[model samples]
Target: MSPWTMPLVSAAVLLLTGAVLVALWLWVNRQSWTDQEKRTLAQLEVVKVASGIALGGGGLFTLYLAARRQRTQEEAQADINADAEARRITELYTKAVQQLGDDKAPVRLGGLYALERLGQQQPDQRQTIVNVLCAYLRMPYTPPPERAARSAKGVHRPLLRNSGRRAGIRRPEGQSPAAGLVDAQQERDVRLTAQRILVAHLKRGGESWGELDINLDGAVLIDFRVSDGLFRAATFRGATFIGDMYFLGIFTGFVSFAGASFVDEANFGGTFRGVTRFSEVFFGGEVAFSGVSFAGYVTSFAGASFAADAIFGETEFVGRTHFRDSAFSGRAGFASAWVGESAIEPGSSWPAGWTVSGEATSRPGRDGHDGQWFRLVRTSSAAPPRPPTARS
Candidate 1:
């Protein structure tokens, strides 16, 4: 800081102290004051009015000091923010280098999170951020083994939080535990900061770690809906099936699919909204769904593998999808599906679908889908107009 800045800061401190003292004194003097009260002492006639003048002057001086102090504090806050931003930028770059080199997916995810935190003060960095997230989304999501009977044990296996250190937050401004306590509003700010960090880390593809393992007891998270969401490699490995899981364009850092195998089906019925790459994608977890829904595209799976019961009973596909040499096991079901035929597909495929009335015995996967599933159901051109053969 400049010499001038130090002095201004010190002056601000002194003024703040003086203002506080003055406030205390004034409060004390007003202690006995009330609506029906007055200076009724018998010594009033003999009192010196100069004393009152002195008090009033002190008040004016206090006001001046307070105003000056406020100005300095504002300056200090700006300085703090600038310093924080600078340090964060430096850390972000350092982490980014480490992320690129580190073998674990989480570290790279951390780097992505750090970049986002840095971007808070640098909004124009949005495009740069897009690359980071996109890289993750392009990875892969694969399944593993097959289980005779499916259970919910591996339905949800959460990944690690890829949040960086800056996820920490300061208490609400102007809230002093000694004088002003932060209320819900203040705490909310802190809460939101943490949430942003978590969300951002997930976006950067930090959740999928090739070196680590995931274990979700039984969670079929199709929408990436749960934050701090968990998953299981065993379930994914035993995944005979996996229902529609969509990102809807959200950024993701990590999503564990370790030792997870698919038996019946797997589906990404939406758009890959942002960076969501994950390494070590495996499917051995048996999963079953009658239908699935997704609003955005899907992406990312590095070293992810899949095994059994693969079924896509009825799933919708809306964007570009690629499963670069990914594997699947057992009946990769794509029966009675109604996906949007690519604009290039024969225009006669407007599939009207339905949701599974009961827990779908299998997840749906198909070419053109519209978020619906049907059992023992079929579509026809009105049975060939009833063949009007009789001419009745």
Candidate 2:
């Protein structure tokens, strides 16, 4: 049972066996001995039994000491192995980070892959590796302009869009004038690779990092799409989505896109379970929130501007919703949407002539429903004035 119990029992059995052997020898020589010899033989038998027990105990002690030494050596070896592994991970991490600073785009891409492989092999380093990728995307970058075609006269015109400093041609420190120009197209490719590395490990299925928090504040993403994924506490505040952006996933904690700008089609169809904010966000293209559920403490779209058609079809808002001073340049649709426990704050913009039904407010919490429900209804056909396009 206990660790000491077996050893103690074995020691007792060994000592008893030694005593029995000594007694049997004395009994066999009893008839062949005189009275004087009998006395001498009894004394010798006592000494023999004592010596045998002492020897047996000494052997057990030696065995225990050997076992203890072996255990200590194994523990020390394990410690050494652990230290060696830590050093290896540190070396690999340092080398990969250095690779990211290379001037060549191919070298930077290799660094990104190296970091991804490292994260996959070491789960404890995944969050740190993701932060590195996010930091890379946050670096100063200008998207490449559309390729210009040659004129009919066989002359190439100077590209005006994204010209000068915005064209990513700024000189770096200690660089020659001839090598000062940075290739925007090459930098775009490197940034795209970093974004891909983040997304590849965040989705469901093969080698996915489970529900990690992401903070991409002020980062620029190109043609980003995250579908059927789960996240905890994601932040994209002040970030810029250069192309079509899709956030069709689930957020279990705080999510913010405050002051963000979506340049192309922005679609969001997911569930937000914490405080969700889109305050002052600018949507430059068609925006949709089809079948989305906001079940957080607050869902704010205060001062947000939509340049194209905005749709909220079959969407459910289960918390406090704010649309204060939001401007939509195109048609705003709220078809089949439900709002729960939301107050119509002053200066809040809604769909034209939309009214909240009082009867629907009292019907929730009945029939196993969640909260107070508010159904939106249209009372007039007057459309809101369309605002001017936000982009220059």
TM per model? 0.30, 0.78
At residue 9, give the lDDT of candidate 1.
54
| Candidate with the greatest TM-score versus the true structure | 2
Residue-level lDDT for 350 in candidate 2: 55
Residue-level lDDT for 338 in candidate 2? 78
Tens digit per residue, CA lDDT, model 2, 1-392:
37996578677867776777678667756646567777677767776776777677778767877898899999999999999999999998888999899988888888999999999999999989988888888776766554421122133345667656357655467853223233455677788888877887888777789888898998889999888777888999989998888987789899999988898999998788889999988899999998788878688887788888988987777767877667778777875677776544342345546766666555443223366677777777665444534532
Best by lDDT: 2
In model 2, state the lDDT of residue 8.
83
The whole-model lDDT of each prediction reads: 0.39, 0.77
- Candidate 1 regions exceeding 4 Å error are 1-47, 98-133, 136-266, 269-290, 294-392
**Candidate 1 lDDT (Cα, whole model)?**
0.39
Model 2 ranges with Cα > 4 A deviation: 1-46, 148-182, 342-353, 361-372, 379-392
